[model samples]
Target chain A: MTREILAVALLAGFGLATGSVAAGPAEDLKVYQAYFEQHFPDFTPEDYTRGMYNFSQDKRAQYEAIMEFPPYEMAVEEGQELFATPFANGNSYSNCFENAGIGIAQTYPRFDAERGKVMTLGMAINDCRVQNGEEPLDVVKGPLVYIEAYMSEAARGKAIDITVPDDPRALAAYEEGKRIYFTRRGPRAFACYHCHWEAAGARIRGNELSPARGQAANFPAYRSKWGEMGSIQRRFKGCMEEFGAKPLKPGGEDMANLEYFHRRLSNGIPLNAPNNRF
Target chain B: MPYPMISKNVALAAVFTVMHVVTLPLMAQEGKGASAAATGNGPEAAVEQGKAKAIELCQGCHQFKGADQAGTVGPPLLAMKARFPDPAKLRALIYDAQKASKPYTMMPPFGRNGLVSEQDIEHIIAFLYTL
Candidate 1:
């Protein structure tokens, strides 16, 4: 009995030693999220995930009326068709991912331990295409967005459960993403943190800026501006373009890392993808 | 046949050359107002236009006075003379603020991306001098 007790203590110590190695987030993720909540004291945490729609009562009413028939339904139907169809090599996307790609959107933008990088769901889809001897779709729009839309619809209401493991590389990635979020880029020199974090509820060009927390949960949302389905990557590119900065490629390391940092903030929020928005 | 192909290539080159020559002077003429911004003493530009323009462009990120002073993103336009001793430096900073400050500043470059012209920046400086 004493030997067993000694062994258990050693095992517990080992576990703690390993856990401490990663050092966790440099800044508390909870504190970062709280910054947003503190800024908009009127808004409950739930209202922010839907973006600018819930910013004002008048706007919410207008958006709610619009939501009766979300504009991106056609894209969802088109995506369902595309997802069901087989690839050129007689293999389909089902062969690449688990559970035939249903409800898998919430688990993505995950850090692949072997590759030592974040793997966005969009990148995984493209990977399946390339592996099956087909040309990969562009990350921004068209087929990729369509497929993502369908996947997001499938994963609707699933809690965002992205795992940022306590690994040095993962911690480093989160740090890098945090830097990108806060650091200003190029001649149109404003960081995303300045607009989104500092000016969380401020209006810019008919749009109320949302806080960074929980915004990542709903991707492939139906944007009225686009008149179709759009993904997080497409929105990110648009933000950079507005500031006159050269936007990063969709599914690239920086974007995936950015998603990683974001998913941490909305760690358990239910996905409301295929969502309607202005 | 060879002569005809040569003439086609030459004509294409000539067209491009003409475009370059025509565009050069036009660009210089456009930059003429920008150079005058160095002095901030151009007779053609007016101060009132600048005051209105300052409220529209800068009010989003900076506080001016009682009127459009809601912005807290940037530093308040206070003690304008000491903060920027040289009016030209102020113009350069407004033109391309990233160059004037450290590696990371929240101030957006109104001048560099041509979002705001130098002449417009000149008017903004005039308005700021009042503060």
Candidate 2:
């Protein structure tokens, strides 16, 4: 009897220690659990078994069928043709990048020290156009969407690997981007952090807000409200309007810099574009 | 000669005394005005009056409780205290409410309809601060 009691006590002690470890930091855990309970109550450890995984085959097919009717899919198909088509000078877009690599879509919003700017993948594609002596495609226009979809399709299996360089200028840009996100602006006086970072997972106008982190991985999404396809910058513009602030033009420097900051938040997340979102 | 001189001095003193006495209420009114300007209310009674007016008028739509109403006709005022902590900005929002576009078309203007006086709006803001 004495031996059994001792064993029971030891087991209880072990359980308590394990429970405390699982609890984590109280404040972080509280908000994290609150959001999880509200948005994804059914989510489990099994859901995260893989580092980055697509939906099951059936689910993927369902989403694909939904995308078929949208005009954006047509844009992506057009982009694919354009990628292989030679420019008037006989230089193909595939040859413009180093090593003729097709999977360079994910390493964008990179710091370009020569220009002292954070260059998005869309911007890089247009830059390639200029080098080829063709009129650069407008980044905000529908043509860019096709080009992006085409390039991203080429990078289907490639992992996202954007590096924030250790250069002083690059570091300064990151810090500036972070500041811009946190600083309150407009008549409503709301900062990006107030909604996405701080109040994430909370209900806003009957919608569950996703955390700003791990956001860049999914883009070129089919927004149910928009009833069409949109890229990250388009969503950023919508958020600005919601805050009662004037939105920056799509493909502008500020948008690129902001994307650079947002991408850093999702450092290791895999790129999944043209995904469905509500 | 002595009687006339005494009467003349008495008349002048009487005139001056009457003038000072008549101006005493005006001086008191000025003091009250200064205090009212400093404290934003002429007296404590006015603030009480304003609170009563807010409870009657603004409480219908701006539910002070944090619970989700069946129909969220207007934006919840529970987190508003935190959202608009600044008193001046809060006052501006109430007084110049048209600056914000409503999600629905039916929210009527309280100030424009003369349902709330400027003083009542100030008091309602004060009451919101307490919440």
Shift of residue A243 alpha carbon in model 1, Å:
1.1
Per residue, candidate 2 scores C-alpha lDDT tens digits across B13-109 of 2433453365445435544333443333333434454455555554444455422321223455655568766555555456544433321122334
lDDT string for model 1 (A36-105, tens) is 6566677654666666665667888998888788876777888888887899888988898888889988
Query: What is each predicted model's overall lDDT from 0 to 1?
Result: 0.68, 0.56
Candidate 1's displacement at residue A277, Å, is: 2.9
DockQ of 1: 0.13
Best by lDDT: 1
Please report how far candidate 1 places residue A63 from its true position, in Å. Answer: 1.4
Candidate number 1, chain A TM-score: 0.84
Q: On residues A1-278, what C-alpha lDDT tens digit does candidate 2 reach at each position?
A: 23223222223233443345442223322433354345445544322112122224454465557656754566568877877788899997777676453777777779998888888877887888888988887664466667777666666545566666768787667656655655555554456655554445444444444566556666665567787666778888898897467887788877887888776655445566645565
Name the top DockQ candidate: 1
Worst 10 contiguous positions by lDDT, candidate 1 chain A: A3-12
i-RMS for every candidate (Å) is 13.4, 17.7
> Considering only the true interface residues, what is the Cα RMSD of candidate 1 after superposition?
13.4
